[model samples]
Target: MTHDTGLVITGLAKRYGDAAVFQAVDLNVAPGEFVAIVGESGVGKSSLLNCMAALDTWSEGRITHDGVDLGQLTEAQAAHWRREHLGFVFQAFHVLPHLDVAQNVALPLLLLNRPDPARVAQMLDAVGLQGLGERLPSQLSGGQLQRVAIARALVHKPRLILADEPTGNLDPRTAAQVMDVLVAQARQHGSSMVLVTHSEAAAARADRVLHLTAQGLQEPPQQAVSAPNP
Candidate 1:
C-alpha cells in the first residue's frame, strides 16, 4: 500500500505574546502512520496539532497535506479544505445532547449537504454502536460517548485525523480499547493521524512518538518506558 508520506513541518514555531511555544520544528507522517505526541503541561502539544490541522495559525513555517499548503488558505478556503480532508476527535466527546447518536455522527455529511442513512449506520456499527441510534449522549459511558465521536470523525473518511487528549478522560482499560479502535480504523482508512496524549500507554500505540517543547517537536534519541522509582 502507498501512503502519502505524512505532513512535513519545517521551521515550525508559535508564540503567545511574551511566551514562546515551539520553534524550528519539523515533522513527517506517512499515510497509514499513527503518530503520538507527548510533553509536559503547557508545552504546546495541542497548540502544535491545532496549527497543523489549520485550526490555529502559526507565526512561521508551513504545514502541507498532500503538498497543499495549509497556512496559505483563505478562511473560506480553509473551511472547505478541512471539510474535505480532515477529521478531528476531541478529548471531550463533544456530542450534541439535543441530537441523537445518528444525527451527531451524520453532522459532517449533513454539513457537506449529502446524507446517506445506510452509510451513517455502517459507521456507527463500525464503532460498535449498532443499535444505539436513538440513544442520547448522556445515556452512554465515557468510552461509548467517545466512540460516538470516533464514528463522527471517520464518517467523512478524511485524509488527516487529529486527536487531542482523546483518552484523557477514560479509565485505563477503556482508554486502551478506544485507542485500539482509533488506530485500527485509521489504518484501514489509510489516514495519517496525529494524536496528542500524555499517557505513555497511549503514546506507545503510535509508530513514532515526539515531544512538544520550546524547540518544537523533538524526537527523543532514546525511546522507552520505565517503571516509577521505588
Candidate 2:
C-alpha cells in the first residue's frame, strides 16, 4: 500500500495585527501516518489545524496536498476538496440535536450530494453504534454522542482526518474509547490523521508526537513516572 497523497507544509506562519501566532512551521506528513501536535494555549494549535484544513488562510507560507497548492483553491473549491479528501472531529462532537444519530451521520454524505444508506450504516457500525442510529444526541451518553460524531466524520470516507481535542469533552474512560475507535478506523481505512491534544494519554496513542513551541516543533522527552506500590 502506498499513499502518494500526503501533506506538505513549508514556512507556514500565521499572524494577526502584527502578532505572530505561528512562524516558519514546516511539517511533512506521509500518507497513513498519525501525528499529534501538542502545545500550550495560544501557541496556535487550532490555528494550525485551520490553516492545514484550509479553513483559514496563513499569513505567509504554503500548504499543499499531493503538490496541489491548497491556498490557491477558491473557497468553494477548498470546501469541495474537504468533502472529497478530509474529515474532521472536534471536541464538541457537533452532532445536530434535532437530527437522529443516523441523520446526523448522514449530513456529510448529503452535503456531498451522494447520500448512501449503506455507507451510513457502515460508519455507525464501525463506531459501535449499530442499532443506536435512531437515538437522538441528547438521549445518548457523552461516549455515544462522540461515537455518533465519529460516525459522521467517517461517513464520507475522506483521506485525511483532522481531529481537534476530539475527546476533550468526555471523561477519561470515554475519551480513551473514542480515541480507540478513531485511531483504529483511520488506520484501517488508510486515512492520515493529525490530532491536537494536551493530554499525555492522548499523545501517547499517536504514531508520533510533535510539540509546538516558540521555536516550531520539537520532540519532547516523555515524563518518567515512578511505579505505584503494589
TM-score of each model, in listed order: 0.93, 0.93
lDDT string, candidate 1, 1-230, tens digits: 22375677888888779677878778888888899888888888888888988889998888888888889899898898888778999998899999999999999998888897888999888888999999999899999999999999989888899999999999988988898889988998999999998888888778888887777677754654332222
Q: Candidate 1 local accuracy as lDDT?
A: 0.86
- Residue-level lDDT for 69 in candidate 2: 86
At residue 195, candidate 2 shows an lDDT of: 93
lDDT of 2 by residue, 51-146 (tens): 989999988889887666899999998988888788899988888999999999999899989989999998888898999888888899988988
Question: What's the lDDT for all of these models?
Answer: 0.86, 0.86
**Candidate 2 error regions (>4 Å):** 1-3, 224-230
Off by over 4 Å in 1: 1-5, 221-230
lDDT (0-100) at residue 7 of candidate 2? 87
Query: What residue pairs are clashing in model 2?
Result: none
Q: What does the lDDT read for residue 135 in candidate 1?
A: 94
